[model samples]
Target chain A: MMFYINQTSCISPQEFILFDDNHILRKATGGKLFALEPNYKNIPSAQLRRMGKAVRFGVGAALPLLQQGNDVNGIIIGTANGGMEDCMKFLKQIIEFDEDSLTPGNFVQGVPNAVASQLGLLSHNLGYNITNVHRGLAFENSIIDALMLLNEHPLNTYLLGAVDEISDFNYKIELLNGNYKQQSNEGTDFYESGSQGSLAGEGASMFFVSNKKDAAIAKLEFVETIHSSDEEEILNWVEGRLGSHLIEMDKIDLLLTGENGDNRVLKYYTAIESIFNNKISIARYKHLCGEYATASAYAVWLICELFKNSKVPLHIMKVGTPPQKIEKVLLYTNYLGEQHSLMLFSKVK
Target chain B: MTAIVVTGLGIISSIGNSAEENRESLIKSRAGISKNNNFYSRYSTLLPFGEIKKSTAQLMEELNANEKGVTRTSLLALHSIQEAIEDSKLTLNQISSSDTALIGASTVGGMCLTDQLFIDATTASKGSEYLSSYDCASVMLYLQNRYKMKGIVNTINTACSSSSNAIMCGARLIKSGLVKRAIVGGSDSLSKFSINGFNALHILSSDICRPFDANRSGLNLGEGAAFLILEKEEDCKGKKVYAKLSGYANTNDSFHPSSLSEDGQGPFLAMTQAIESASLDASSISFINAHGTATENNDEVESVAMRRIFEKVPAFASTKSYTGHTLGAAGAIESIFSVFNIINQEVYSSLNYTSPIEKTGLVPNLNYRKTSVQHVMSNSFGFGGNCSSLIFSKH
Candidate 1:
């Protein structure tokens, strides 16, 4: 079974336009990286202004695509940090206000499925709605749910995506644990020559999945995620999946690894580098978008563009191989060696 | 119709940490709900909970685990998963990595660490050493990394129905040929936020929940995780099958965030679809593990749904009476209960029930009765109008 991407929207540190934007690999920096394209005013109004960063990114990412697929059968949104930002904010407010009276906005938005609920209210698409909130597996589970729906009834469209945001506490905790370096400036290049760590970036990528196959840009062939045991196990598993699909080791054209310049995780993807024999082009997105739990979602949106436009961005592409046939591309990513995801896609007819 | 079979099962709740213990507890009508052990807050004194009597130290010793900061949620997940995987008798290391997938659910992954963070969030810039636990995804990913499975480690949190969705997704994986075997379950530990949040809603009972009763006031929150190892029909050809997962469906109310829609439309859609999906007549179901949160709004909506779907309402009871609302683990935990119905051929009572709610004229069984059980239907509805019902049939 296959599902079509009827419409897709994203909110990244770069421009807030959809993935079809002209500017490729727009650089992001500063204390916190937010989607350049988020137009909160365009999505909703002051009545629901209490939404946190996750909800805003979620709405901005989904609304436009949903408008195109208003008749979409269902909505499934994935959030790594659903209402954490709201929860944190609410907890702080309660502490500061001496618990006199708590506001409903924070508590309402703090619910894990707030984004999905708000989407239901906004679009009035009452067919089916589910919000999947598993850290790195957030989008994977959402994608799987959407796939199941497509299998049962071939729902014409599904709003599928992932969103995560970093709070002041996120950075403060990082700084305390040495995950964040001290004295880093606003313009610091996270993966530059002297850069030591990846900057924190947050956004949402919502896809309008359908089965009509009309004017479709890409079709989802198959996607899988695994929790890797170690560096050796991840590569072998990737090879194993490729073999099961009747594709050989040497045939893989592009291998997108979720390496965030971490010495440990980078090495896991590194061992497979020679196995690809440099014939398979290797790509890393943490340099472009920075690293978080669901950085792979951004990586996937990036690869979707690469499939459409054969010219890959030189900045993000690590190893080079031209998109000669662009027939089958294998995208692989690991979240700190715990949950690893692989999405195989081919240019559809 | 595609058939998804439940080849194996495992569970760990306050009442019973193992399948055998759980059955005995259910037969005797013993409850695991009690008071809190921590001296963390005054709320513990006010709230008697379905607290798992075991301590973290004891769980660590049982698993022989070296790593620390593993939340009670994770521990419950590991415990249930170990039994489930073992019950399936499928060698984990023997199967191809691509054919095995691990799907776990949790509402809050490591918020158990939040108590430790609470101290630091105010005084210092950061919390304790385990900032990673603060992210729900991180905890799940940690589980995936530990297991070394390559197929999928997807975490789902649709509020309370989170685990039920996880199990359904696992079955779909098998039906889709994504994997031949999938490990599915959900886990959640009681936390300050959930306890306080439910308290704020004024939908929490100070004592054990009396579900489906006329005077049913509110729900009791509990903690634990349960899981089942699902395999393709071919994978379990001659094995003794515990129960077959025949039909399952999930529907949303799209109503209020915390409350169900007035018409019980969510459960209405879910039950009908599941029954239809199972390709079985409504009369086939002999028992139902109702969500029956006992909140004024929940019990009415759900029972109205049960009455609407089944011409003769089956012997339905809310097991939440014994195992509070386990949150993300409710679906998996109840799935085990439903399977027990398939095995024991008996219906457990809805404890502390004096009269049925007049709104629907629906009355849950107030006492245990022995009978032949054929099909059991389990329903789990979460905060987001996410409603899911799964059907388990005698194999």
Candidate 2:
């Protein structure tokens, strides 16, 4: 089933760019790559003050897309750690106050569905609002739901996206688990540092999707996710998915990967890389966005940019000759070598 | 188009450990709200909750789930999912197949260990085993890894209506030919995190809840899990088919984050759309499982919505009066109860109801009795004005 990406917006670590403008990729110098949030002058101050970073980026990125019209049938959001700042603050307040006389402000905003709910409230698009919190597959699952809903109702437009914020408390907790590298290094340098952990990252990306091909920049062709550590199993699944679409591996113009400089999981990317065999341009994005559960959302935004520009950005290209004309792009991302996701996108012709 | 049918049901709530036990409790008009004995909380003594009687360790041992980093939420989910899959007679091969989907929902996934997470973040230099399980997706991820589920595995967290949306999503998936079968439900364990959160909101009732009562106080937060196996009607040949998932619709009030509109527009749209989707008239609905949290806002608004939808509202009751408000798990647990209403051709009474609200003069069924239940509508409205309605009809 094909779904059109009618409009796209993102707030990531990289500098915000327009569809026709030249892109500039930013690099994280430390273990954390925080979002370069735009000024919320467009949003009402009272509402903006209550939103956490995730909800801000989410509603900020989504509100503009809904401005075209308020006919959105649903608002779907995905996040692994939603509204973390408020969640932690509420948890801390419970302890400090000994669970007495605490306010509901933070608690209400801390729930994982806060983004979708907030968007629904702001846009007044009281449709099928939902949130997906599945680890690495969060954004992909949102896409799947949007696709199914559109397929069920072709005329319906949906606002789908993902958001995750990096908090001081969460960062420290994750550091204990070695989810981030110990050393401070440039994003690109860390990719080749042969390290054990990837840099932490946070961002929000939203897409307006519908079944209509007109006015669409790109068409999402396929999306699939799996939980496996075996490289061969993932390889076979990718091939099977492509074969179902009747597309040859050589036909893919760009192989976008979520290689976030984790040495242990580099082999999985390498295994997938061998299938292309230098036939197509391969690029990486986590260097710009860092590595988070919904980093794939940023990848989708990048794919939209590449399709809009019809060229691969120099900073993201890692291997293979740049394609003369970018047509079909394949995105393969893995979260710690366990959660594997494959998404295929093509220029809407 | 293929019709979706519920072939198997599994549930673990305060009233019982299995489906049979729950059925017996409902038949005997048993209410499960009580003081917490297994879960520890500051208000555990002051407030009543629909807490499962067993401890986490006992649940783990009973389910043989000794996996590291497993939380109580995951354990409850595993207990119910085991029963669901077994009741459906689905083999490991079928479960591991790519055609099967598991869509779980939870608002309190692994946040049940908020205390541990707090200690690890604030005091301990090193995180505990519960560190990785602190997110809302942990429960579904744990279940997926345990079952080695190869198909679409996703988790939805839309507050209290989470599992209703899960069930709706599963039905849509099966109807869309995306998957052959789906295991859909939600699980939430009572914890200090949620208790404090609810208390902070000033919605937690000290006494057992009284849904639709004239002078209802508030809701008692509960803990439980429920899963239902849904497949195409054609697929369940000789299985113990419970009911057909005739229709479902999800809508938002777009009104407030924590409160619905006074008119209950979201619930009205949800109920109307769900009935329309089933291609049935509002008059056909035999019983309704209302969202009624016994709050001043919810019960009144739900009654107004019911009045708007039906000329004379059918026999309806709030199972939350029996189970307390189970939050994320209430949708599916009540959905299973709705199945019992169909399979047994009966309607369970709403407990502790005295008088109707003056605004709507709506009185819920106060007694359990056998009836010709053909279609049942289950309502779940959650935070963010997320309202959903599901209809189950006799197969």
Maximum-lDDT candidate: 2
Q: Can you write out model 1's per-residue Cα lDDT over A73-104, one digit (the tens) per residue? A: 77888877776677777666545653434555
**What TM-score does model 2 achieve against the real structure?**
0.98
Best by TM-score: 2
Q: Residue B350 of model 1: what lDDT?
A: 79
> Alpha carbon lDDT of residue A8, candidate 2?
95
Candidate 2: residue A167 Cα off by (Å): 1.1
Local accuracy of candidate 2 as per-residue lDDT tens digits, A1-349: 6799989999889785533225545767557888899897768999999888888989888888887675688998999888989999999999999888999989999888899998888888768888999888989989999989998898998998999999888888777877888885764788888878889999999998998888798999889888888899988888788888788887788999999888889999998888877778898988778889999999998898888888776677789666778889999999988889999999976
Docking class of 2: high
lDDT of 2 at A14: 77
Each candidate's root-mean-square deviation in Å? 3.2, 1.5
lDDT of 1 by residue, B284-393 (tens): 88889999988889999998888888899988989888888989899999999998888878888878788888988888877778899988999999886888999999
Judged by lDDT against the true structure, how good is candidate 1? Answer: 0.74
